[model samples]
Target: MFRFLRGLVLPEAACDEANNSSRYENLFKKLDVNEDGRVDIAELHAGLKALGIPLGKDAEETIFKTGDSNKDGQLDFEEFMQYLKDHEKKMKLAFKSLDKNNDGKIEASEIVQSLKILGINISEQQAEKILKSIDADGTMSVDWNEWRDHFLFNPATDIEEIIRYWKHSTVLDIGDSLTIPDEFTEEEKKSGQWWRQLLSGGVAGAVSRTGTAPLDRLKVMMQVHSSKSNKMNISSGLKQMVKEGGVRSLWRGNGVNVIKIAPETAIKFWAYEQYKKIFANEDGKIGTVERFVSGSLAGATAQTSIYPMEVLKTRLAVGKTGQYSGMFDCAKKIFKREGLKAFYKGYVPNILGIIPYAGIDLAVYEALKTAWLDHYASDSANPGVFVLLGCGTVSSTCGQLASYPLALIRTRMQAQALLEGAPQLNMVGLFQRIIANEGILGLYRGIGPNFMKVLPAVSISYVVYEKMKQNLGLA
Candidate 1:
């Protein structure tokens, strides 16, 4: 009974010998209302109606011609079964003949060959469609697994139905119809600390740039292909940068990064809040996990959107010292030198880092805020100062720790043109070389100063953003 019920729910397929005949036999036995080898015209009509197949003009004649092999004006189970078996056999033969290699696999080239043999010479446009239908991976090659998944009907697979359901799920919250949650009252959701946030994050970034600039310069110098150092230690690398470019060259792109970060954080924080609201529960209440998840996703989205600028900034920093005047000049020079795509160099490393960096950073930020509010300012109406300090320290540390290795790879890839000339490192090759030459520790070379930079940078950023939010009352 369960098997029959399951079959009923399954989509209709081309009728086959045993199954079709068995189905018709069951209907014949029901409609005949008496034990008989044949079904009358009236009985046939009733059976067709029951099966949801319409019997219209010349229906009786058609039935006799199709099902009644003996011209007996009615179908017997044996005759019907014979017709079904013949039809099914033809389809199976066609499929087998197309499998030219007889490897039970169908590649694109084989499919094209089969089609030509059958005298259905597909046009280029038509060929593309045929390829797409069978090529599940979009690789332009149809393997046996792909053929079976797409072409062959299997009782176990409902791939199309599952995909359809996935497509239909979750409408985005858009327009005026989408209401903002009111968990924190309008008054309670006060403005952010714009100026304070700005100064703190900005100062931290400036200081970080100053502190780490020499190390960054050294790292870039060591990555230089022409540099004959088969082995470059940090000490030796630093000596090289200082000797070649002078001490001032270490802080080369500090101004550009400082300018970029303020607006970067602005977009990041704003987009994060908006995305949070979107992914958050319809209920006003959101848990720590949800907030963390939302914040991380938001951070990733923001980082991706702004990464081109980061590429430009890094290029300006590590390239020929004093060659580029500022961000705009660097942008222009990069475009002229390597094309616009160069600005998005190291996108893989940049994007991959976002997942873990954002996840850990935002999770820590929120956790710190909650802890501070609970322990330090339990009775305070506004947990502003405590939240800002906690968020700054936690977020920056998490982000730097999670992202610095990828950061190293990105730096190398970005400077490859200037440093190595022509050749560049794909993400895999760069990491492989890093591990091979310097060991795993090589990837985290500048991590010390990076951690130092993040504290003030993130702290000031959040403090400014929160102040702005408080002042604006955007909620």
Candidate 2:
């Protein structure tokens, strides 16, 4: 049943191993649920879930088969002890491997080195936070005993497994349209499954973006064109777009939008890793502010690298039909007509927007989660999946709301040349012109379609991601 799961294991740390049998007994009692002196599959699943180790069906079956010596579909005390002892032996081996130079301890440097081998990069300071979690003595290093005790109940078979969980995104979207990349275990990397995961995510993103392209194009149009003379509401905006171009023109800029996701995500993730090192605190820990600063800087770095594409995207979205052949042609014309500097129009406001977007996103997300916890603590300890997603969606929308004017201005600045007789304005002047001409409401033109696309984008991305995972044997 678990032909492909037999080799997958968790990382092991060493502990006293003294009174190990008794420890096993206590754990067994806990998993036994009904005090029947045995743990069946159902109880075992529940117990593992409580430990926050989500195992797949194949992994669960492999584990169950390994410990059920009598073939009874359950673990008696003796079998359970034997299984744990066997696991500990492997855990000790894992610890020995991590203790480079035969030092009998794992230091932050060692942790960093080990992860780099698995394609996960982190600075020594970032590694220290990981070390602090298991370094009970405040000695800044983990001995075998501390390692074993720290992960006694964890199902992770290797350091990579634990590290993946630690580094995984908490849905703390610090920038508009930016998501932290997914982390993968060593096994996944070695087996070439990491790329598959990335491919799936990219596919999901493409599908989501394409599905919402019409609204996106409309949003860009309204952001650039709406003023005192021309108030382009959603209804009129759609008709105007259709009048100018065919139905398919609604997706004018989508090709480049989908094409840019890969490089943008790659650059953003790489920049984030580097930024975390720079922002690392002396005390070897990262808090909300640190995270925000690191993420904001990373988002800036990524945007700077990809800003040209951003300009191209804006241009293509607002361009008349047959204005340019395609993304390449659009870029060529822009480069030829305007100097390289035009590609970076509105760079200041774009970077400025990141701070508020990230800060408010993080703050509102935390507040929402806290409120959810406060209200539902007695009923449910964990805010279920839907609640978490809801909180994330609302928090992200709030962040966009706070930063939308900046985005609107940035879009206008990019598409200024496309609009004939449109005043060439810097970020500040753009703001003044919009406010003087169309009032405060004009600053948020096209927000209706922007909000309208959010649900469909989220839903499509999620559904496609899950489907892709299953297709790639990751589910």
Candidate 3:
């Protein structure tokens, strides 16, 4: 009976050692250029460079000298193994340095001080969060055993391995419905590669928006002219668009829509990261309210910066074939005719929608994630991919529902200039007129298409985003 139970339980410690050994062997082979069974200083330097590790000549020479035992100039396999063992010893010594009081346990304050020495400016709250993540025994601090167990099996010899380790171990709070990987090494942050985050986010946004472009254009059409004599439903909307400008018209304005994603995502992600630093509590943990405020402000920032493009997208989506040529032509005509203010026609309603959409999306996602973890997971393991997708779809739907009326009003305002004999209305005036003319249901004219696209759009965005990050070696 005991032997049967033993078979059921995995030998995690042994497996971890085997994984580390395999990684070491692969790295050694990579460094041994020409299969010469030895790694010279040049080979080591070349291998490190290939892995994107920035090392000066002096640093490379020093590393080679340290690894080359017995006064030899090259590292044989046994010498390479010894070098790794020495590295492990050095890491343990670094951990011991954090235990300033010689208590064999490292506290939050100690971690903070240690990182400060390495030029990492983190708050005490952040230190506590890091400690909590690794404090497996609920001790609130890492003992020697815990420290050794966590770090010994993850020896990173190059920048790529360090990045991989960081990605696997750290949890980032990006204040979005998606659970994106957001950890960056100190060097990466200092080098101003924050643009990588922007690139990944932009790609994700473009993919999601393009995948749902037809539904999006339909939504715009319905919002602007659904109550007019045309009486547009989804099928009639598609047919009318095709009849007007061919099937390609369904994707009109998509160029501007996709182009704005890079700047918008960059601004939003950068602003949210800055706001997180500002809102972190004494324990470095941001509460739900703080997260909501930050996310809303970030969305507003992105929207404001890209509002002109949004105006162009809306106009192109609803314009006739001869109305304007393309995005630049549309921009030139709008500027020549209506001036800069036309670009911000729907500014108020667009900003207003951000609060409800982001708030509801984040609140629902967190609540569902928490409930699932409580009921299903054993020890705070990450929820499955399908679970995350379900949560994202439900939360996104709720957010869309909460904010659809304002979105409709915004779309109408954006297209108001194109309609002959249409009266310009403020956000409140537009809301009142829509309700009075078309009834409450009128505000949700194209919501069927909107709802139909939300699930697949979000799922594809998240999956593609993760894969892109992995390909870029950021995840």
Winner by lDDT: 2
Candidate 2 regions off by >4 Å? 1-54, 57-83, 86-154, 157-175, 179-196, 281-285, 378-381
At residue 166, candidate 3 shows an lDDT of: 27
lDDT of 2: 0.74
What is the overall TM-score of model 2 with all chains considered together?
0.70
| Candidate 1 structure quality by residue, lDDT tens digits, 211-286 | 5555545544544431224556666656666676788777776566556655655565566567667765665434
lDDT of 3 by residue, 434-454 (tens): 889888998888888788777
Clashes within 3 Å, all models in order: 13, 9, 2
The list of candidate 3 runs beyond 4 A from truth reads: 1-147, 155-194, 228-230, 277-288
Candidate 2, residues 369-428, lDDT tens digits: the string is 667655554322344556766777887898889989999989999999988887798988
Q: Which of 1 and 3 is ahead in lDDT?
A: 3
Clashing pairs in 2: 9-157, 10-156, 10-157, 10-158, 11-157, 11-158, 13-148, 14-144, 14-148
List residue ranges in candidate 1 displaced over 4 A.
Answer: 1-185, 188-239, 362-399, 448-475
Candidate 3 lDDT (Cα, whole model)? 0.70
The TM-score values for the models, in the order shown, are: 0.48, 0.70, 0.68
